[model samples]
Target chain A: MRGKHIKTVMVGGIFLCATPIMAAEGKLLATAGLSQLEGSGGGGLVPWATLAGYDSRDETTALLFMTDVNITDYRLSSIGVATSFYDRVELSYAQQTFGLPVGLVKQLSVGEIKQNVIGAKVRLYGDVVYSTYPQLSIGLQHKQLDDDSVATALGAKDDSGTDFYVAATKVHLGAVAGYNLVWNVTARATKANEMGLLGYGGPDNNGYQMMMEVSVGLLLSPNWVVGMEYRQKPNNLSSVKEDDWTDLFVSYMPNKNINFTAAYADLGTVATQKDQKGVYLSMTGYLW
Target chain B: MVNHLKTALLMMSVLLVACATPTKTPISLYEEIGGQPTIEAITDNFIDEISFNKDIYRYFEKTNITRFREKFIEHLCVDTGGPCTYTGDTMLKVHQGQKITETDFNLTVDLLVNAMKKAGLTYVQQNRVLKVLAPMRGEMLYK
Candidate 1:
């Protein structure tokens, strides 16, 4: 069934690409942000206010992305599709696969975990560059795990959860020694543990908590960007400690059709493992 | 001999002062990007770009190319702090009946950027020009 769904989506993407109502690629280069881990438009670890495509108010655009993170003792891979409508609203779907360490898989009798995330965002006000004020947006991500046995064994209160966030982003042309500078700040409320890979709230905590995230980037040129992002994680699971996430990334956009990003990520500790750090790589292709 | 040396030093200092005074007046964006010739070239290139783009060309089908050329040059000159006045209609008035969509407006901007690039404007220079004109986007979109 999942394979059928993916095939249908790809066919639809190709059909949209051939339609006359497709987006005009109206916005400036690099203005539309890359997909975040949860499939929202943003940096590697933080969601920004910008949408996922460069469409203007009169057009619609769709894109697909794949991301991989190989950290110490674990690996994660995500695939997603996103679309923006008239630059006012964005919707996305993503599936994440988390590979467990050999020892843990043998001990717990589970090799990997899969989760699905559905996201929606609405732009509230302003443009990132043209307006006097920063662009603001509100969004949510609903996550569900494929299986709950591991979560149940780990004392998780739930296998599903939702995260609500508000983000503000801005771009200042020629602000830094004639180079464009972009920044974003986001506040999210959630009860997820390890972004819901290990599951939602634990016995110690069962309520949603607010966390903050930030991203800053400098456009070295119209095609190249260097940036840093920080994401604050919720400590809902008492059995294990959750640490914040940080990354230094470089993105290269040779054209509007595609972009590639590579990052050095520090994910901190997860499930009693200390200092989980690794490289994260992602690619996005614009279909329209 | 002493008097000659003093007079020579005095002349050298006077010349230095004269050159320093003009340097104190910062170069305007217009002059920094090559004055009238570059502006004219950008206008011509912009017109060519519009003519080639079918979507953008529709908006200018009824426009008078000559008047647009003259007025656009003047408008850019004034926006860049050059010595010129805009004799053309206000942006709002000009675009009121057009009902321009955001996509079309931004597409126009992209054409303008291409024009600037062809006219030998540096990336920094192009950004500076965009910064000055970006604030006026509201007047041009969705009239």
Candidate 2:
């Protein structure tokens, strides 16, 4: 009976967490970047050093996000939530679904791939807006794939693994004709192929490889941002050639609690699909 | 070869002329923010806003508004590279016994941002001033 009650409470908690609640009123405007695809506070494709939400040093902020990407040959969808405490540390969770064509699915013996990502980030030093030094953060993501059989067929050695990264972000006020510019650089160590949709640690090499990611944003106004991102990936699977990803995006905040983003993404190639380019859209709601 | 030589000579002359031309020095933050009169007006408006704010108003209950206004204007002017000197106490010295918290500090900044907006300061100008003031949070809070 006790176990049944606990299970019921857990199910209720998931539903309650999806609703947006009113947050504290004192956070600075647009200090937090938009939610990345993996649920971190960042651009569309890459994570930045900024924490999620507008909460200042003394408050806590919560964020919920949903995103969809439609490429020429595939579709990716994600839903996640994140929280930042005292503007110092962040915790996030996301569930991703990758869908492919029926022919490709048959070839790979899989219809779709599903993943769950648990992420944590800690601010180390500096302020992106008010300091001369760039804000620096260290983050980790532990990803678990749902289907181990498909991963095994693709020469994957592990179904779950952790990615470690360090990111630096800086905001330059009045950088170009009085507009603010935000720049970020991140170094990641990971063994995940295509962010673990194809699983981790291929047969050729079951070791982590270092990769670089970069994002730059221009503040067109206090509530609008235009940005671009580039992310380099490692070639873990010899059968498939992995290429870099790039995107151009625009984000708008209607108020402190709501934000929307749209982008054009060039994923290069995934699996056997070539020139896998498409549209990406995301919406996020903030709570305190 | 002769045409290439002529192009090279023309390019060299243009480069030399560009190098010889005098460049104008950029204006300082004080002048860019409209100098003394504008700053004084902003300070007065900011003081009014702060005086009405419930969060930090208790700290200013016994203060002198006129002197505080003058000191604030002077402080901002000197901080922004204007030809003025601040005669008030340092941030740490003044807030040493105030027992200010981070919430108090943030509220004060919020009021200041609102006042700057009300006074018609552009976003860039307001951020420039806020950047200079933001670092003072360390010295003024809980000290």
Candidate 3:
């Protein structure tokens, strides 16, 4: 019962993809100062997906970096950066760390579940300077799992692998209000045993699995942004497993050098469990 | 060798013809623009376009438009070789911390062209204005 409920929540997790906000809907949302937190094939947080907003810059090329944290019993964190060339083409990279503090992740523990992701993105349409077409981009993410010690500890085959995803993004222009949307589909080698940790779950055959995500954001002011995201993952990998989370967040940018964010997240449990909820406060710094 | 000599004579004849031609009176594009009167006429149109506009300098009103109009014409005429003197300070000195953005600048460009139209300037005359002011982009932007 708990596993099914968690699975249901996964669909909503798509909107909770990336919550880096501040100015997401405006003449500026499409043309923010830096894309460190925004600008993708889809909204922020969709791995290897494209976005609606093109790289809209007119002066010396632009660069941006952002980091978000989820505060709860199970620690999770995400960091990202995006840079544009000639205001048309763009490139980005990100890393996500889940199950932080490892609880008891002794380097000796075999088959310990840890997920690290690296990604790149490119913008292919809509001129950053003057164009009527909605800006578009494409992306790819490489998800890697370290399973050496964990393999021996579990007496099973190593559970490390990768996941691929594609996405699209769009921005709506208006006289009073602005909005942005991003969506994507993820493909994986197998279901059940992928990025989740067994150290956290008692006896679930959780393995590398496939999933999908969709994220969106709205700008309330020139300097403030609010957003929500939800993700769906495979939960049938084992007898004891749960999936899905919903995230609501807000971000503020005082200048080109810094962005501050706060968020509320819902992390479902693995075995006969309850919804694990928490808040995260994080600060991001940009170099160059 | 005879053919080569004939070719050299032909080339020299063309060169001599080109050099002997007298230089026509060079007309200063600024003077052809009708000097201060031309700038003043365009300034009036730009003021109407910008003063009534809500995007840039929306805070200024009809009276403010007249005052700014007078100042701008004086400035443009002086800068473009018209017989006018401008006492205004530097552009950066005037717009410091005004929060002026590129959107506002583009809109101003639209208004300027609209004003020139009202002043009966032809496309060539309009381009003459831009050819001078466009190069000042570095001085007018960023701050």
Compute each candidate's TM-score over C-alphas. Answer: 0.88, 0.85, 0.47
Per-candidate DockQ vs. reference: 0.21, 0.17, 0.01
Cα lDDT, model 2, residue A235: 80
Query: On a 0 to 1 TM-score scale, where does candidate 1 land against the true structure?
Result: 0.88
Per-residue lDDT of model 1, residues B1-143, tens digit only: 23323433454355334434433327888998899998899899999999999989998999999999999999999998888999999999988989898888888988999999999998878887888899999999888
How much is A106 displaced in model 1, in angstroms?
Answer: 1.4
Which runs in model 1 stand beyond 4 Å of their true positions? Answer: A1-24, B1-25
lDDT of 1 at B52: 100
Ranking by lDDT: 1, 2, 3
Q: Which is better, 1 or 3, measured by DockQ?
A: 1
| Candidate 2 lDDT tens digits, B28-140 | 88898889987887898888888788878988988888888989999999878899989998888878888886557766877887888887889878877876676787778
User: Which has the higher DockQ value, candidate number 1 or candidate number 2?
Assistant: 1
Q: Which candidate's lDDT is highest?
A: 1
lDDT of 3 at A12: 26
